[model samples]
Target chain A: MADISAHTPTSEIRSAYLEMTHRKRLYSGLMLAVFVALMVSGFVLADDRNAGGFWSGLHRLFDFPAEVLSEASEKLTDLPAHFVHFLPSLIETVNIAAASTLFGAMIAIVLSLLSTRGLARWPRLIPVFRRIMDITRAMPEIVVALVLIFVLGGGPVPAMIAIAFHTAGALGKLFSEVNENASLKPVEGLQSVGAGWIQRMVLGIMPQVAPNYLSYALLRFEINIRASAILGFVGAGGIGYDLKNAMSWGKGQYDEAAAIFLLLFGTIVIVDQISSALRDRLTHGARLEATL
Target chain B: MTTVTTDVITDLKGRADTLFLRKRLLGFALPAAVLVYLAYIFFAFDIPGLADRANLDNGKTLIRDSYSYKTHVTLDNRSGDITYAIEGERKGTYPDGMRPDWVSDRDGMTVVDLGRGNSVQFAQGFARIVQQDGLTVTARPDRDGVNADLPAGPLPDMISASKNRLMVTLPDARVTVTRNRVEVFKYAFGWELFFFTLDSPYHGMGFPTLLSKAVSGEAGAIWDDFWGNAMWRHADVAWALFETILMAFLGTFGAAMVALPLAFLAARNFTPLMPLRFAARRLFDFFRGVDALIWTIVLARAFGPGPLTGALAILITDTGSFGKMFSEALENVDGKQIEGIQSTGAKPVQRYRFGVIPQVTPVFLSQVLYFLESNTRSATIIGAITGGGIGLLLTQAIITQKDWEEVSYYIVLIILMVMVMDWLSGLLRRKLIKG
Candidate 1:
């Protein structure tokens, strides 16, 4: 019996290997067929002659100019023009973002309070409010701009609205989550002393989550500045408009664009540095309080 | 007993007085009223128009009728002048004998003599016939170019009637119809009219015109025209999306990359030096304080407008995020494995590679993958500011008063691209983590 078992040893391993190989081949073949079908359909249905010609022409036109500019700019300046232009737009973009973020944070606080189960009379409404938050967050800022462009007639208002709405959604969700996960000891103690919801929130929950809120708000501000730069593309005037103009012209003015971009980068770096420092202070303060 | 109870009550009242103050008559009520008023204003302010059934219907009609006109169109080319017998029986007809002189052939389309001075301009899939007087001469909108316009209202029945009858207008501004815009009742002919003439053959006016010129082998000229003149003409409205993407990517990735080393320092389990850990933690907070877009504009100004500027902006913004996230993950790592590696007389580098890395690699990869997917869309936004890619295309389409068809096309393409990136990133993340 021992000899027979030894003879059949490792048969299961071999069979499993064989089965895996067979499955792999099947899946590959299926995927290949689908890919081929797609290629064939695209070729057959597309206006290939027109599309191909147009693409080739566009490549030639844009590429040739870009090449010439790259060479000329190399000779004329020590640095690329794109570098120079990017600097200022970057700064303005930061300013817009910072303002929007602070505004968004203020709004988010009120909205979060309304959405929170702990504060609401009808706690069941929390889910409904959460769903609304989800919908707002789900939309990209671009889509928001598109919709608001129509209503607001293509101005900073649309961009501002888009940023505010998205920030509110993001911050509200974060605030609610933080509140839910917070330690209940302090809250309970306040409640036991007959403290109202507002008082408890101000004294207990806010203190615990304030640092986190500030950090998140700062992060959002950075994001909003970038978003504001693009808002110009939809006629919400910003640095993006000038950049588009430069590229479209295919002139060597990439220096201007570069300058603007550099400005944006530097501004962001400085702001980020400052924000991180502040965040460190807050967190450290929180840690000290916790230890005490 | 009564005196004792009174004293106790007095003491309780005195304690309450210290905690709460009685307000003047309307102090609290005034604030409440103001709050209510603000809420009312917010709710009452005009909300944007919803995409309701009626609005969509109106948009559809607008698109359909804008293309539904009959006119005798004459094309002027370098080879010669070619005349087309355009028959428009409906409210959307191209007028006969209309010549648009301002339309140059070099510009891809031109108008020629249709037996009179009246001109018709044909480009892309649609044709515009303007009377010498410079008013829309084909089909007058019933409500003075408001209500009865094809885009604003329903398709008029006049189109069906002029199927066979070639109504010709003299260059002298004389208009004539063969049979009063009556419907032809023959199946074969009717079918041809419905399928071939009324329906759009090319995708839209701008695309087809551009494509047609390109296919004609003037590819370079077409591209130059598109990029130089067309794109810049709407620059203010087309670069925003590009800027947005650039900012997001730079913010997310920049933060992640910078945070990598700091994360190591901040990890109590991994960091042998207590001071380094504390410093890294402090640094992480400073970086994360500001938002990403703010960084973008700042960088844009510092670097100038381009993808690099956008990237730098994103980098700074993301540094804080990645630092915090990475530090937390580091703290949560299993201490036993770290201790075991340490016991083997492994150096800090070896311990990190064999112990900490193995544990945190999955989380790090997942975060990176998520950021990449998010950044792809963000890249488009940066491109809007930096003047590159599809965002620029979208902005141009909107500003030129071009048909929404082009706008829809760009949008759908962007969405599909984003979906593909999302799917690809998700797959890579799962495979890398093997989870």
Candidate 2:
């Protein structure tokens, strides 16, 4: 009806467009300035607080790696032996990750089902379940692990429980998101057949979401491996505890540290590669099915 | 023809039956595998031994200390000096001539009212405790070991007396006496001297009176006392929390900045040189494969223990992740937009700025924001290892063993900080990506 831009004067339109562009540029420039200022100041403040200044530490950055490498190379023959010695600890670390992931994924499945819209057993309490997930997810693993370590007196069990608690919440949110995309037709069919809540979920929804859940759980396994190792550093029984022990012995025991590092790096890369390949297959299969 | 068709039908049925059998076997096998693994882990992690190692008493103490505090009324028997302190910490000691209302000095005798009809009396050389049930226990320390006198019926489990020391642990209070001194710990609820220490003029002022004083120009002094509170260290805690957030902010953005350029080289479409792309990709992998835990250790050696080290550790680890994600995003970018820009005779940089950046900015920013939220948690963990931020404070408190209240406070703060960051990031993502 009213073609305002067409009816407006060309000179006025040009000025208006220029003015808007100017304002946009001004805002963006201001934002950039603020961001830059924050970065500069934060860096300076951190450097000030740090034991070693940034400029001083910059060149020495490679020193630590070099020291470890030289020490490792000096005892090259012992490297394999060191690896063997640490293998059990490595296995224990991996086991911690695997067990935690399993327990966490199990808890996540229940939590996700209870919180997901339409799939929720008690729809009125959806928010309650969601809050529980959020709160659990918000807690850092170290916090819980340390507290448990205090009570349990430092063991793999404490680390296992801590990681599992975090994994449940983190995976629960993702699983619920996956659930929202699932079709309710199968669930309705199961309900019509007088299936119980658990039976309905098991027979109807799980088959559709199993691949995605597995993919996510595999990713979580990789992350939990890292978490378990770190928890070990804080005195949970694993390779990290060994690494810390080796590190605290100062220069002489670096070969052990080096071996542990190699083992950790190798395990992480292998696990990452395998899990990523599996995830690709899982997601790719789903996509192929969708196209069909 | 009928016979041939019957054969075909039978073959199909046989195949279906075999498939069902295999599926049924698989269903059982998977759960069986999980069960076996769990059984293995139970032994591997030594779950059975954990029961013996677990200190349920430490758990009880941690829980109890988190909610309640204890005030100690100690009498130096030799010098006849009575000093009162909360939590037995020197910082919490009452100033000279001042003590808790429950404790009073009368005629050279100090009486500690431990509430609920339980009271402890500390005189020149003896300490006496009267229980709520009217059972009185007296202990004297003179020349030799402690001499304890209790009701003859049977010594209650709460009272443990030995040759040189006597301790009576009641439900609401505790009394310990030795040759050197007599100490009575009266249990109380809430964190004592949280805002102002006993030495401060405004230590016990009511909220209304404090507010009026603040309104009347004592605000700065009041704030100073609260902020510099020795027991709570609100100022240091605030700085630590800020440092944590700063570590996250600097790390996430820094990684994004570092990764953006490298991602171009890593992207197959952007860099035609196979070797360069391979190198870039491997570099990213190397960065990522070296876990943050290891990076924190290495960087801590270079930068020493501080937030900077933690930040650098996060930055380095996330750079790898961001590089991989960014390069992937770059590879998937719609070429039509860049081609259109190119057709206008724009330079490569301009093409990227006007065409590619706009398309990928939403995804990039959203990913960065998500990492920022997650990195806040990482910062805390890193801080613990590297000695900075609330993480360091938290670990210290936990290690101290007696500062359970402080540990709880730090835990609450950390949870709030992470939740806030999560909410903030989500809000920003919605605003930027959708709007």
Candidate 3:
């Protein structure tokens, strides 16, 4: 109150502050307006280019599902037989997922160790390995599966290879993140004991990170199961291939489609439950270790 | 202490050794199991049969065509008129009175120089391939059949001779002479006519010349030519890429907007009604369990094939994911802030706005952004199945079984697009959440 000569008027400060807030509000409003416009136009463009108009398609949305449901309900008695028939295909799908996860995890263990800062065999080439993982991770599995289907002639093997290739890249990054938290003391102790590189990694690092690695690998198995099915739709072999064939067969094969659906859905839910339980246990155990 | 029993210590040592032995056995057994399973898969997947089914020729074509292109030199034996085209595409055909540098006409005889002394001379009714290694072959298409003269000393594998046709394969080019026409494929590096089609004046211009032309105010024309390239369909491909991104964008954000409110309905603190919360949660699980593949199939029947259908498929799938994640995030929000807002005499909606939203918005946005990054990939796969985007082009090119170069192009573009999205989403996440 006494330093009037040095102080600015309160009203002037208030107005300036009000002006700033107004401007801020106006800018936010403008951004929202632009976003809304973009969304609207994008929708319209997509609708216009679509073979069936949105409004027309909206009415018929449930037609195929309704047909499948009705036919499946009528042939409910055959569902059991159909399920038995598709069981082998479902097994193949699960096998693709399990095998790919196993192979991919093995590759990821090596890649993760190579890429991790302290655990790397060739520390100088960490960035190189990281970039390789990035490129591989960016490559969509379908591209590989489609190409491999051309070469390998449409089998589960292509799907397995593709999913495994992707899983290695994806799991490698996560595994390296886990590796970053591992203690380096064991590694040093092994080095002092004249342990070779592989021995050091196997005895020193793997035990520390194996739980997290297994958890991630199990999570990957869940994802790979879905991926294997999708690849089969694109012409790789599995339940998805069987599903596509059944779907194309139409009306008469609705029971088969229903059976495959039941198998796939059941398998997905069951695997998800098992893997999540294992993951919970792994993390819980890790937390216990940390607390101790 | 137990009286310092010596037998007890030995028992402990024996147990430790047994445990270690068990672990060692397990280490070997596990690897052996994996090996045995792999052998079973090798037999089950029929690895041996694949050798016959697998088209090694397609592999060769894919590898070769990805990096190099071939120009075709065809002489219609009937008209004696030769036309040259890149990749044998009509859109790449040389216009009248125009030809590549490697090809020339002198006194009604067309000479295709295949470099390194390997050359082909096409005349009135005969063709001569002069190989770089001095092996020569002459083919004259006649009334009965093609008259072929092979070089002495057992015809090499490079040359295939028959009554109706004679084929000579060179390092740089391949020549096939039949009764109807004489064709030679000359190899070159890089994609030809990638920017401008054969009809464009800018097609064969050198960089320096192009710069001068652009400086002379021909930039718009040059761009138009490039963008409108018939051989590449640059405009359509660009549009497809845009559509792919648009699908992912609309799907991810739309799902977020739809899920946020519904997530509150499912959250334990927000929704006290047990039945309603259970219904909302189960709906989310149902949507997720259906997966994007089945959803795409179902939606494709309704909407037909387009980016719209792909968008809807992604939207439905992601809504379930967002609902579950967002509800969990909502449940985790600190109750103290909301209680403070309530104590301030604020209404439920106002309390949510002032207290709850701010705490969870970052979590919500991070999850959405993560999904946006991943949904871009899903959109590509969905596009492949439903017939839209670069995936469609990739599948089409691959299915053609000959246009492996285009498949390579589409693959590179898809990867680049995905990486760009990945970088962009990461940048935005940092800016929005942390900043």
Candidate 4:
């Protein structure tokens, strides 16, 4: 209204806005169409390659679950015994996660510190460390685990190494992000006191970032637990190995599979709950209520 | 009053000392605990035993095979017919009367140039290795054994002679003679038959020649040969990569679409019914708690192994995650915009459309894009289980034990794929979120 003049009409502005709106709608429609086309074609291609049709398989989805449930119900008394038998394997899985997280987090702390701009010991080598992290992160755990399993034979060691390898890369990126937000005054103060690089970092940055690092490492632990289990299924040896054995036996052995599933499910839920609670404490302190 | 202040200062000092003491103790205790746990794991995981169980030779073979390939030149002692094959594979065998440029055949005599002034000559029943440093090793195969002649004070570590076999291992070539066959293996760097196999007309064509042929309208044929290369199977690998990406794309977007509406139910701000909200939340938890590994197994049972199973597994698992995150996002949306829209006589749906969505769009899109990149990796792992994508190919290549070259190729491709996806997602996230 302030810019309006005697020669310029309101109709011209309205028409211009309308044309822009029309063009936006057209582009949106085209984008939506392309998205739909891609989804539909992808679905069709996947369906074609699948052993069973999606439509046909949809109804039978519950059948396997029902069978497993029924068998477990029938063999309900054996559940406690099965749990006892598989408990050590469960502990092994948890240990794999915990150890890998510890190792990975330690490596990540060094890597993140080295890669961060202001805190870097050698500014020139930042890109090199960053590239190392990127390459490590880009590698899937299964790839390394399988290759290691070939050389080292199947065991928890391979799985542990695989998960730790990936966790370092992942946690390194997150920790560097955390490092960026930290004030450099403490580091400078420590440096002015003639403290060495390690001492400066240990005395300065760690206190500021310890909580966030713990929170992220805890989260990675949860993820690594799942990863270690999956690696076990591929012959790396854990509870998942037992589960695979139980599953491969088929039908009559469904009770064992059920027990393994319950143990895994329960462990995951418990770990998830505990870690989230711990993370909440670390991040929010006393401000956030006990939601769990 | 001074005494009271001094007492307070002493109390504060006491607390500070206690806090510092606790921190010092924790600093030591945490690493100590970690070390103890690691030591326990070392024993429990049998790390010491690993040395005994581990096969170092396999590692050597894997490392060696990844970068270099060997061409087998075998002579049948009885018939005196020589055969040249790359990696000793039928698919890489030279055609009858055709061999490498380094191998020459004239007057029933064949000499293979092993490079670095080393050569292997086969004439009649005997094979001789000629070294530039004035060392000649010859072996003649007979029914019982190989008769070996060596200019040796003591046989070097590179040469191992037995009753029925005489073997010489050098940096460039290896000659092994048994009772019935004499074989020379010439090692060369790089993946052999990567582009075109022995059957293809363009197998050994130079880049300039290939370019000229392409300019002369032979591009499609050349591409077809490369694509359909039996040794490498480039087309299958490309398709597998596409399938892996497709699984990620379809799973991520599919989960987002399915979760958005469900998220409204789960969100405390959107749904007034507590029971319904609880139900939705529990449903999401159950979906997520089952884990993608279990979901993949369950879906594979129903759908059978393919990209569909992998995609559905990712979809179901991610739906849970997206639902929780989306609902949390929905709960945190600013109510002022919705109130403004409501004051304009807008219905609930219209209010959500104009007011709520714009605020949440950036967060939701960023989350979805992040998941898209991660799901690409998950798709790879799930593909291994379900037998669909690059993971399946990688696992297959690995399991073959001897196809380390192919395994390395697939690994490089996978890493590149993941990095590209990561870059693409980051680019899209920045572009879409900001613009």
Q: Pick the candidate with the highest DockQ.
A: 2
lDDT of 3 by residue, B130-248 (tens): 88777789889866667988888888998999999998888878999999899999998888788888899887789999999999999999999988988888998998899899999
Q: Could you tell me the lDDT of residue B146 within candidate 3?
A: 72
- What is the per-residue lDDT of model 4 for residues A22-43, given as tens digits with 9 covering 90 to 100? 9999998999999999999999
TM-score of chain B taken alone, every candidate = 0.51, 0.97, 0.95, 0.96
Q: Model 3 misses residue A268 by how many Å?
A: 1.5
Q: Give the count of colliding residue pairs in each prediction.
A: 142, 0, 0, 0
**Model-by-model lDDT, in order?**
0.55, 0.93, 0.88, 0.92
lDDT of 2 at A231: 94
Q: lDDT per residue, candidate 4, B1-435, as tens digits?
A: 999999999999999999999989999999898889888988999999999989999999999999999999999899888888998999999999788889996667788888888888887678888887868988877876788887769987888998899888888788888888889899889999999999899988999999999999999999999999999999999999999999999999999999999999999999999999999999999888998888898899998999999999999999999999999999999999999999999998899899999999999999999999989999999999989999999999998899999999999999999999999999999999999
Q: List the residue pairs that clash in candidate 4.
A: none
Scored by Cα lDDT, where does model 4 land? 0.92
Model 2 lDDT tens row, A151-262:
9988899999999999999999999999999999999999998999999999999989998999999999999999999999999989999999999999878999999999
Q: What are the runs in model 3 whose C-alpha is more than 4 Å off?
A: A1-30, B4-22, B106-108
Docking class for model 3 is medium
Top of the candidates by TM-score: 2
- Ten consecutive residues with minimal summed lDDT in candidate 1 chain B? B182-191
Which portions of model 2 miss their true places by more than 4 Å? B105-108
Encode model 1's per-residue lDDT on B174-230: one tens digit a residue.
Answer: 232222221111001111122122222321246667668679986775544443332
Q: Which candidate should be chosen as best, given lDDT against the real structure?
A: 2
Mind giving the per-residue lDDT tens digits that candidate 3 earns over A1-292?
A: 5586359788887899999989988997998899889888988998998889889999899998888888889999999988888888888888899899998999989999999998898999999999888877878889888888877788888898999888899899999999999999999999999999999999999889988998999989988888888888988888999989999997777778877877887888788889989999999999899899
